[model samples]
Target: MKSLPETLPDETNALQKMVLDYQSTVDQLQEKLKWYEEQFCLFQHQRFGASSEKCPDQMELFNEAESILDSLKQDDSDLEETISYQRKKPGRKPLSKHIPREVVRYELPEAERVCECGHALHEAGEDKSEQLEIIPAQIKVIEHVQVKYGCREIGIG
Candidate 1:
C-alpha cells in the first residue's frame, strides 16, 4: 500500500474553502433570522399591546386654523387693549328645529282644581323640558295597479 502525503492536496484545500464559505453563509442567515424575529415581536406589541408612549397633542392641530384667523383679523387699535370676554358654562346643546315634536298636556281633576280656601285654582305658568327618543326603522311594500279601456269602433285597444 502507498503512504499518504504529509501536506493536503489542492482538492482538499478547495473543499476546505467551500466548507468555510458555507459556514459563513449559515451564520449570516441566522443573524438575519434573529433580527426579523425581534422586529416581529415589536410589531405585535404595537398592534395588540397597550401603548406606553404619550399621544401627540391634537388640540393644537385643530386650533391652528382658529389662531391663524384671529391673527388675520388683528388690528393696530385692537392690539392696544387686550379685549377679554367671559366664557359661557358648557352644557347640553339645544335640539335641532328640523326634528318633529309631539306635545302632551296634563290637567288636574275637576275636584282637585279647587283650593282648600274654597276658591278655584287658575292655570299659571308651566315648566317645559325635552327628551330624546330613538325609533327603529320600518320596512313596507306598496302595490300598483294599471287600468285599460277599449273602444268598440277601433281595431286596436
Candidate 2:
C-alpha cells in the first residue's frame, strides 16, 4: 500500500491559523451567552422577587397576624366550645336615623314614561340608597330616590 504524503509547512500554518480563529469566535459567543444569562437572572429577580421597599406598618401587621395564628393553635376540645348552632352572615349596620338627610330624587322623562304599547306608565315603586357625606364641620346623609314606572295594560315595565 502507498503511504500518505505529509502536509506542507505553509498548509500546517494555515490550518493552525484557522483553528485559532474558530477558537476565538467560540470564546466570544460563550462570553456573550454568559452575560445574557446574568441579565436574565437579574431581570427575573427584579420582576418576580419580593419587594425591598416596605411600609412602616407592615412589620406590625405581620406580628399581629402571627399572634392571631398562634392564638388559633388550640386543643381540639376548645374548637367544640367555640361553635354555635347557627351562623349569621355578616352584614353592614344600618346608618343612624338621627343624621340629617338630604333627598335627591330621579325620575324618567315624560316621553319615556309612556310604554311602547301606547299605554301610560304609573309610579310602581321607589328605590332608596343613602350615602354619608361630611363637610368641614358637619356630617350629613344624602339619600337617593329613583322612581320606578310600570305599565298596567300589558304589564311591561
Off by over 4 Å in 1: 1-91, 138-157
lDDT of 2 by residue, 19-118 (tens): 7877899999999999999999999989997677577577788799888777777543366564557887897777899999999999998988988888
What TM-score does each of the candidates earn?
0.30, 0.43
Clashes of 2: 0
lDDT of each: 0.62, 0.84
Write candidate 1's Cα lDDT for 56-132 as tens digits: 67557669988877777774435566559878999878766666666554666667755555566565535455665
Candidate 2 clashes between residue pairs 3 or more apart in a chain or in different chains: none
Identify the candidate with maximal TM-score. Answer: 2
